[model samples]
Target: MPTILPALAAGALFGLGLIVSGMANPAKVLAFLDIAGEWDPSLAFVMGGAIPVAALGFALAKRRAAPLCAPAFSPPTKQGLDARLLGGAALFGIGWGLAGFCPGPALASFAFAGWKALLFVAAMLLGMAAFGRLSRPAPGPAPR
Candidate 1:
């Protein structure tokens, strides 16, 4: 209950932020991507506003041993840029450019976006499931 409550609150706050940022609207995102056409620069501003807050959050998180609500901090273990990473990033960019909704905004769009949002979420989940099934990490050398 304790863990779930914090997760829910965070998700709600995130959804609210997405709504306020205009990220929940695919048209706005598409417009931002359309540099040759009617380009909208609001997303850039939103990201600019978020950068400092995110940097501060990361700094504060590093200072703390663990989150106020969590047991321990589990940061990314991998740092190298490999083929699989690059390929996945390319696909993510392609999808974002075509659909104008990444995971967070996509989820937020569900309420107002109707069937197109539902279809996108379904496809996104399918892609994720496929990736999970296909991208098993190579087995390392057996323990000595």
Candidate 2:
């Protein structure tokens, strides 16, 4: 199968899941975060539902010879926490507090006509691109 087909299918399914679980609503997420205020524990239930599904997928993948698309599985092996990681985490927390939407939920929230989500996604993409450039190696003289 084509790569685009799998990507599109995955995105469609993820969007549908977000819609069904009411994750596309920033109000719901904000309520969940507001523990001392009008607290909504519904997000916990969403996590509870997703965790098992994710665990099962992981288990199945481990048992498989190879992923259907690739010969080897690509997983992050980074274990050390560095300045870049900490900075990214701080930015993520600030963004979550200010906008009440992370990247996935922000994109999902777009389905519900979220203006903040559109802004958030645009900024997030820009941030990613900027970080990519910032992390690139500097040009230097090659060895003989």
TM-score of 1: 0.89
What lDDT would candidate 2 get against the real structure? 0.83
Candidate 1 lDDT over 82-115, as tens digits, reads 9888998999999999989899998888888899
TM-score of each: 0.89, 0.84
Mind giving the per-residue lDDT tens digits that candidate 2 earns over 48-70? 99999999999999988888876
- Per-candidate Cα lDDT values, in order, are 0.90, 0.83
TM-score, cand. 2 = 0.84
Question: Quick one: how many clashes does candidate 2 have?
Answer: 0
Which pairs in model 1 have colliding backbones? none
**Model 1 stretches astray by more than 4 angstroms:** 137-144
On lDDT, the candidate that comes out on top is 1
